[model samples]
Target: MVTDKEGYAQLIQYLTEHLGLFENAGSGVDGSTVMELFEDLLAAQIIVVCGQNPELSFSQRNTIIREVDAIMYDLEEILAGCGRQQVNREQSYFITEFTGLVKNLFDHEIAQLVR
Candidate 1:
């Protein structure tokens, strides 16, 4: 289902695992707060994406994926800036290059974060 809640839930779960934002409490002083904000913002984006027709066209899907890629990159940079995490900018962008929301969902679930 392309509903907002489903996509929001998936992104939360994915971020929980990959970013360890929800699990790792002893990370930093303001890190948890930032992570929470990130979740809220990401969920908000997903809500808009899900509001669109579930059966999105190729360009629609790709546009959403691109938006998601950009959002994730920004969040990752924020985390890295605060020394809470380390991510390779080039590597992350590469993931977006081949990222499609349907098949590579495990790796691209965060790409559902679209406005």
Candidate 2:
């Protein structure tokens, strides 16, 4: 299991690295790259969750994974739409909203784990 501080640091680093994806919206954003990013985010979430709750049952872990996967699917659709269009005001807003959602996840759900 990772130490709380270490896990927190890793989450922060992950956010830092991926923030650029939003910053450079519509810049050759491909489906594969988007999928890769979502996969990485899911991995980070799972690691942090499992590290914090080592005693979680297998079923519980599976449930958590399924929930996160559903959320990711919705976000992925929004991102894919953004990628398919020119970077206009509406798309920019969606990108901003998506960034906020990710940040909020770290700030609330993930931070609660590490804390």
Candidate 3:
């Protein structure tokens, strides 16, 4: 979210480019609800990044991270393929990088209190 549309676009384009190698990329992209969840996470990103909600517990925050991690892992599993596809998997780690991006977005003050 901090990187804005350009950042998100760049990541999406990277993903789509690699996914171009997939025999059934479109179905994979469209059939899953994970993409929609990513959109939801992006929408909620501001809250987590800014530490906007005092009521959000550490467990809750970690749970959010775990959910995102699971989604990314599932995506990576779905993407597993031919030897050449390994390059794409490596390149698309940006999918999980979303978690790092979210974590990094936390304010310095907020991050210390997170754990």
Give the whole-model CA lDDT for all candidates, comma-separated: 0.44, 0.50, 0.46
Worst 10-residue lDDT window for candidate 3 reads 82-91
Give lDDT tens digits, candidate 1, residues 1-115.
2323465456445543555432333434333344344444455545555554466666766766666666566556545543333223432332233223323342234344432
lDDT score, candidate 1: 0.44
lDDT of 2 at 1: 19
* TM-score of each candidate structure, all chains considered together: 0.33, 0.45, 0.32
lDDT at 90, model 2: 37
Q: Candidate 3's residue-wise lDDT over 24-48, tens digit each?
A: 3322432323344344554466455
Clashes of each: 0, 0, 0
- lDDT at 78, model 1: 40
Q: Which portions of model 1 miss their true places by more than 4 Å?
A: 1-33, 53-55, 83-115
lDDT of 2 by residue, 43-96 (tens): 665676567677666875675666566656655554563333335343344444
